[model samples]
Target: MTDKPSGKSFDKLTRRQTLAAMLAAGMVGTGMRSASAADFAAFNPGYAKNIVMPAFAQLAAASESLATAASAGCADPKAPDLITLQQAYHIAADAWADAQMFRLGPLADGQRAERFAYWPERRNIIDKQLSALLADDDTISLDAAKLGGSSVAVQGIPALERLLYRDEPLPPTGCAVIQAIAGNLVAIATEAQKAWQQAAAKPAPFAANPTEATTQFYTNLLTLLQIVADQKIGAPLGGDVAAAKPKSAEQWRSGRSLRNIRRNLAAAQNALFGKGGFAALLTPEQSALADNLKKAFADAIAAAEKAGDDLPADVSDESRRHLATELLVKVNHLRDLLRQDVPPVIGITLGFNELDGDGS
Candidate 1:
């Protein structure tokens, strides 16, 4: 899914368009500012040092690569499979780029440290990059295995594919998955914003470098998480799989459906955690995300049975499109709570953000 076409558009981006995108969004110099004080200060920094920044940077750089890759093949497709690969490449790269571009100033360098305008430019880059990456896919090989080994192995044909009709385009299951992550991101960000609001109620001095550092970190995390949420889920949820034009709506749907599970898996995201957390078979992949997700599928299924709904349909039905959109928002909330919960850099900067705790 990562190979790219080296075309005029892609070449143009490297030469002129990239600068244009950076400039148009004022990311080259002006525009975009940092977030407020409370946002970064709340998280543990010691753990975050090796956690957030580098990952954020890597995601940024990788996304850049992905965008370029996608630009090369965003448009044409000779086979149904190739279309799927193209879309997946575009979606994955799109997600990564979007996540890294959150509070882009941390990524950008300038006199005033602007982020707003920079991110908008970053947005344009994502769109253009997707287009450019897909401009000519003739060079791309749609050799089934190359597109990830029977993207529909047992495969392709399933309920998940239902969401990907011409009207739906992106497929229901995948869209649901995308929606779930995005919604959580927005919700989490809103929570951070609320925390910021509360900070206003108890406004503390952030003039101290430690406090400034804490504030900046918190804001960046909030912004970054939101970006991750939106890119991985929201954009894809609203995308047109038909643009890639998979062989059949069914094929498109199934691929997208499976992607719902894959995106979270790839991002090291989980869909089950907390109370009633199940003891289920852990695929080698699920091990990483298990702690972060709510094990609510069984519960939803049981509830669905009691309510006289079909099990799969019942479980897949979402009160909200975030995880529950893909899988229960409330349960998702529980999982989110469990998130302060996990990750490699979870406790790096212990108590660095305390009012008198001196971040260093």
Candidate 2:
């Protein structure tokens, strides 16, 4: 469910609008000046090079490996080959989770976000689509490009997870679909990596507009935090443990739900406040806000890791649910710091409404 679409809103100003409004509020700390355009530009290249490009490159490489392994498994369909393919899927899944933070640039174009990793699936659509494809063997041509253009439910990671992890044995059609979807992932990741590479090589418009990039970075961080709190943990947790939906957890089929959140927080930390990051432009008060946010993210990740790998199971346990709730609190606190404190120090303004669309 990485960067999965959501209907939630920040209920304040979007991060970009907040940044602008912060400038007029005169809220910047004493002896601190607003970031100059030069400040924005100075940090942009490093952020692109050190954070954004590497994420896509890793995704591209991991996806290529997944495609190769799936092709071999499809060719052989033996127990050993399937095991190898499963391992490859885990590696690629983790890579995809890490890169979920940078769901901008080519990744957002043409609904590629939905196409790459469609999730929070409605009505068990992946199951329905995969079942139908397997049932009608002759109807499945097994072309990567064509399949990618088909129902998005069957075109990405969630679909592949269903095929690989289902209770029943994999049909020959399932194997074919696995290979095809893996190939599609490879193609998409390669294209995205190349796009980032080109942008990094040149100063794209995003590079020139540091404020916009910073705003996007903040929005992305806040969105990830919000989703972690609301959708991933809260939605499934519901009003209480009795209302919990274990199946609602992200990566439930693969059982990496908590791992996904940990990776997301790590990426958010690096993207916003890491060395040579957007945080470098912050005033002293803003620096304090960033530092507090860094701690909060670290604390949440630590709690998540300590809660162990079975997030769905953990959610059902009373004590574990308490820990999960604490993690949610920490994330919300971090989001508030971004919304209220950091923006003003960085000379970003606040707005009365949240961002529309997926913050990613």
Number of the top lDDT candidate? 2
State how far residue 67 of model 1 sits from its true place (Å).
Answer: 5.9
Question: Model 2 lDDT vs. the true structure?
Answer: 0.70
Candidate 1 residues 179-266, lDDT tens each? 2222222232333233333333222212132233333333333333343233323333333332221121112323332233233332
Q: What's each prediction's TM-score?
A: 0.30, 0.85
Please name the candidate that would achieve the greatest TM-score relative to the true structure.
2
Deviation in Å, model 2, residue 258 alpha carbon: 0.4
Worst 10 residues of 2 by lDDT: 2-11
Q: Evaluate all candidate structures by whole-model CA lDDT and list the values in order.
A: 0.29, 0.70
Count clashing residue pairs in model 1.
48
Q: Stretches of candidate 1 above 4 Å error?
A: 1-49, 60-64, 67-104, 107-208, 215-326, 335-360
Give one clash count per candidate, in the order shown: 48, 10
